[model samples]
Target chain A: MIQLNISDIQHFSVGDGPGIRTTVFLKGCNLRCPWCHNPETVSRDTVTLTYPKANKSVTYGRSMTVDEIVTEVMEDADFYRQSGGGVTLSGGEPLLQAEAVAKLSQALQGHGISVLLDTAGCVPWCRFEAVLPSVDTVFFDWKTSDPTIMRERIGGDLPLIKSNLARLLRTDKGIHVRIPLIPGVNTSEEALTAIAADLRETGAKTVALLPFHRLAVGKYEAMGIPYPYRDTPPLPADTLRRAAEILSPSFTVYAEK
Target chain B: MGCIENFITGMQPPWSDGRFDTPRFLEYVFNDGKGYFHPSAGLNTGTAESITSMEILMERLETQLRAGVKEYVESFNRINVLPDPENYTAPFLSLFCKDCIGRGLDINMGGAVYPSVHGAALMGVGTMCDSLAAVEQVVFTHKDATIAELVTALKENFVGYEDLRSKLLAAPKYGNNNDFADKYAVWFVDFLSEEFMKYKTPDGGGYYTAMAANVSNIYAGHVIGATPDGRRASEPLSDAASPTYGRDTRGATATVLSITKPDYTKVACGTVINQKYSPSMFEDGRRDKLRALIRVYFQKGGQEMQINATSTEVLKDAMDHPEKYPDLVVRVSGFSAIYVTLAREVQMDILARTQQE
Candidate 1:
């Protein structure tokens, strides 16, 4: 009867994972990524986002038991079976509530549904161990490679994240090391190569370069906070391709739009 | 004003056998209240009866075209080409219609202000399109079965040919935005409109096509045999102009895209596209998406769309416990009715509509 702070459950989410997945965004993140798209989930307290133009308000962060979460996500089991898609436990770093996630994943797996975990890999290794048994795939996000930027700018512990990624790479689960290609943060050749080296050291074989987009401007506006990257243009397609090129020599890279 | 009002008041026809004494000739000629000349009867191209009726209509059109438009119009005035009687609730003028009654003329006999245009309500656009696409792909392209085998299966209502029926069912169906199947729908509207346009009504009114079957699709489906699209005999033929129920697996966007492929300008009597969505989609923020979708559908030349926001779970529950949901309203085709009051088959038909997420 463990309860998890849930933000929102999005069904038929094609971009979250393979097939038609339902993404469960857990509330509260340990790290503060300024350009985070889902800024509403970064806080542990229940937050309401009001949109003036849309004349609507959406409140996130509800306490739902593992059984309730399972029942809700199970509604799309037929779609999952047809599309090879299942449930994706996303963040606010799902590893922050590893125990509830473990229970929910186990319940979904018991129903013959696959479970995927999308994490920033900034939490303790013990948190990863709690959910590792039920998760079929791990989408580990590797942001900037510099320790100073990771610690000061992004508010993440670089060594801890690297250790977690290295350990996750050793597991039998499907691992996808994803890099958010932010323009000033990680688009430079030096930054890309450094990330490539870090991932290579972790024994990662394949990487997906996700281009930075400004789709979160509205989310920030709804939260009544000015996004730091609001004025910044999206990463050009050529920039993503170049990042892919820099990482290609070390590993098989996928340039995602 | 008083004289006109008095004339209107005096125009009520005498009651005979608990019915207005309207023209029995027109009713007898058009086979009123019977399935003999139902507008949908000739539209199900899968049946031999439909083919024979279509041939007769085509031959008549050929003779009229050979005689030329001027002569055809003159001849139409002399001999009334019977419009589908279902278009009028009363075969003659209404009991209180002053002009037609004063002129001693039925409404269809050049009595009204405008000439009567014929609306050949093509019963099942989705069924016809799906059947054609399935026949093309399964029989001709894939060579999985011969025409003889398919006809035999259809004749037997797919009793022993479950495998072949499965192949037909698996073919690209209409309303998926897949042009392989959608092109046939486009052709259905265009070809029928062109043919109907070739002939004029009795009073020189143009012939128009309609996809608005209303509830008559249920009745029309009762007579239709097994279709090439793997529809069982006597099953409801894809409500109105919408895709076959449960066959539009793709979401609402693709459904709208496929439905809008047909040039609706030709469908002067209009078409009805029924779509169902969960109740959450009708909320304020999410409702904008539905509005955007509908706007795009209209921009792409879609005629009409009827959306039902009741979720399948609630609908099923209402069916099980009708007394609890006495006021639950649902859109059945182009109209709305209380959920518990609708016949079980109609409720089942509404439930069968794919709920686009």
Candidate 2:
């Protein structure tokens, strides 16, 4: 009776994968990416978002057994099979609960469902090893190549993330390196070059350039938290193109608008 | 022909005079015509005659349709003289009617006079001709169940086969953000819209197509036999471009994603997407979520959306106790309707709409 601490199960998550997917946003992240979109899921504790304007409050972080979660996700099993889509396990950092994810993925695979794991890859190698067998695809996040930026700004270990990515690439699985081109942070030429060098060493085939957006500003306000990037507008199209130009030669670059 | 003639004659004063006056009535084919496209409308039903035969039939139908309009206009002109000063009730309003004309026809489409047929025939509006639930549940879903058994159950309206109806109810449905069923819906809109775009109205007014049938879907469903979508014979089809009742298991976001997949720009007349959300979704900052949902949908090329904020509880109450909620207005497709005024089954259908949280 393994229970998973999850924030929300987002059904029909189109932007997260190739086809229609159910994104299980697991609670609690290992890294503290300052520009994190889902701030509520950053903590393992049950977080409540109160909207003073709407006079509404929603409490996230629930403990559900693997069987219950699987049963809930299986409702769309027919959809997954028909559309070449399936479930995606994302998080605060799903690798933190690698053992639980392994069980979840095994159950989903038993039903012949595809599993996509979206992670920031700041965890140990054993976590990836434990979950990689059952997972079908991995959306590995690469925020910055600068060790100081990774440590001080996002609370991530650059060496550890790179090591995890390199090892994950060794496995014969669908791996997509996702780079969130944060403004004034990872958008510089030096940072992009370092990021490309790490991916090239790992033999990465595909890279998705996700430009920064202020979509989570409202959510931050609702949760009674001040967003540092509240005034920060979306990344310009030119910057996205520039980043794509830098990475396109090494890998298949897809600029996500 | 007689209807068109009467319509024109009734507006003699308004048409002939340099005045503008509202006619008591103006009934034309597109306004009230309820029929399918001409079989020669080029859908390639796959069982039709050779391409040559189809072309010949298409030419003949086009001639007849155009002639029908031409004859009506000629007869109206023959009987009444326009641009006359005497018939003018109001000079300003009458000025616009100088070029005004209307036409109607009973263009038959091989007895498949469904809304989708008219859309395709007149403007190539794509339609979900197939039901995913029907295919998933009745036709071939159950491992041991055969099509014969499903057909038998459907013919009997599942009266004696409660188990089969339950099974059918459990099948995959559209509007769930799942591509399996949504892909069909997407293709239906795209194909019909593209097909309809290849043609135009006789007067070249840009034949617009619509998926919104208003409350007429209830009546239309009444005449339709048991469909593959697990609908019983004469049971109301899904209301106004919406997925069947209680079939869309996913939330509103998924529904929007699935519905918006169809390219509605081709749907010049527009497509209607009806969704019911809990009133709370409209409150406070939560309304922004709904707003964002709509913005995303529109950005994705959705033509139109009609939202209802009535809770299922209130709708059910209105159905049971109509006197309590007389003024309860529900957006029925593109128009508003009193919830209590709708039929019980229709009310049931509205109640069954997934009220997104």
Candidate 3:
């Protein structure tokens, strides 16, 4: 009986993950990454008239019933057959709505469609395990390796994200690691190399490089939240190329626009 | 360079002799809306019925021409010709007519070009400044084509001479961002606007302008028949094929291009403006750019344009995630197509090009 809040669904999408995909943008997330382009994904409630005046950056989806979510999942059934594409659950964090994701994914798999879940690695293992059984692939965003650094940006226990990631890998669930290249925040060569080495250990072969962009800065104004990292410029292209080259030895690098 | 200028001026190359000699027909076309055959007479796509009030503008142009308005046409090229070695045509005009002209604005001057399969096709225009070297390459340097022979080739569709056709097509056309392309683009636009103002539509609509000339006429073959220009009947339409050419020229050296605005105007009687977005205007981003572009277009003498901005995101989701947003519409290349029915590549391409502007 759990519900889902989804902002938008995209089919024939190539940028979100490997292969063509129908990316389902879930409505909420538990994190508050200052640089998140989709700041709308940072909450759970679809519409809240009033609450304690908190950061407007936090927004989630309207709750939709499982049948409704499944109806959305089956929209791209034809796309999956031709492009080898599948559905990818993305959001503030699909894990926050793991029950809805599992329900929808299981429904899709029943009809022979492949499913993928893209998350910020902030949900519980029970949720992850629950959805993993039905989903075909998972892209776990590993923003920062440093616990305190991660905690400063994303709410929730860092230990929980690390453990959930490890669990997915230990179980050999379809999982890929993703890193956003921020200029000063995570550009240390050591940071790249360290994450690469850990991902190499996890049997996860690839890491997608999502370069930080200034496009979402305006969205922050609409949400009425002071951008936490105004001085952090986007990573210069060459620096990221170098980081990719540096990490190339340990983990397969996938660059996206 | 020496003779192709005639074709450039829209004279059929001599190669085509007795094609449709619509002198009276063409004269009527140039008369604008006042002419008996004016498309707007009964069509009435919200355009003015007459331009009698603009006699002053015509007199000024005539005086300027007679006084030798030596102003430089701020263009990368003037009268670009996409090489149709095969003498075949492309479907660009027909497509524009059938697809882009949904509401029937009566301004889309479809090319004389027909469709071709052998050669590559081109589209897109170069940005323009003012330059002479650019003008020479665009207007002058070309194979010496007799109006008769060119018309014959155009009319005959390059039937017997595959070699000549191949050699002709081998001539490089322009596109992408570059100096030559840009220069030719400016000159070509100015020339057309200048020339078009000389004659009104049969109904006497005002002169048309605002042509986003393709750096080269890759799609020229779409209308490739011999034109009244003495060329064959079915020749390709150049990107410079818009009705107005030089109307945007501010001085002898600089050009001012404008986007059309939504408000009704008397000048848009016979012009075409290039539209780039769709949801807000039928494009997802918004209509500010469209409004701006159209405003500029109207300011610079544009008579026609197209739009599709139905927010591809809405459409993309309906297709990829139908449950996300169940009902959304998108403007396809020419017509409105359901968002969910579009190919993913098409959807992504639309998204990639979507703008906040």
DockQ of each: 0.04, 0.07, 0.02
In what order do the candidates fall by DockQ, top score first? 2, 1, 3
DockQ of candidate 1, scored on C-alphas against the true complex (2 decimals): 0.04
Docking class of 1: incorrect
How much does candidate 1 score in TM-score? 0.49
Q: Across residues A210-240, which tens digit of lDDT does each residue of candidate 2 receive? A: 9999999988988888899999999999999
Task: Specify the highest-DockQ model's number.
Answer: 2
Arranged by TM-score with the best first, the candidates are: 2, 1, 3
What are the per-residue Cα lDDT tens digits for candidate 1 across A1-257?
Answer: 79999999886566777766779999999888888999999999999999888656889999999999997777656556655778999989899899889989998889989999999988889999999999999999999999999989899998898888999888899999999988788889999889988988999999988899999999998889989999999888788878878989999988765
Instruction: Please report the interface RMSD of model 2 to 1 decimal.
Output: 8.7
Give the TM-score of chain B in candidate 2: 0.63
Off by more than 4 A, model 1: A1-257, B1-113
Model 1: per-residue Cα lDDT over B1-357, one tens digit each: 110011123333211110011011111212222222223211121322222332342343233323333343445445555545566345433544545756655554444545555455666777877876886788667889876677678768899999999899899999877898998778767866776678766556666666766666676676656778888877887776788888987566567768888887887765777888888767644555566667667777876788899999999999999999999998776578898998888888889999877
The TM-score measured for candidate 3 stands at: 0.44
Q: How far off is each candidate at the interface, as Cα RMSD in Å?
A: 10.1, 8.7, 20.1
lDDT per residue, candidate 3, B44-107, as tens digits?
1112223122233233323332222112111101221233435444334334333324433221
Clashes of each: 0, 20, 139
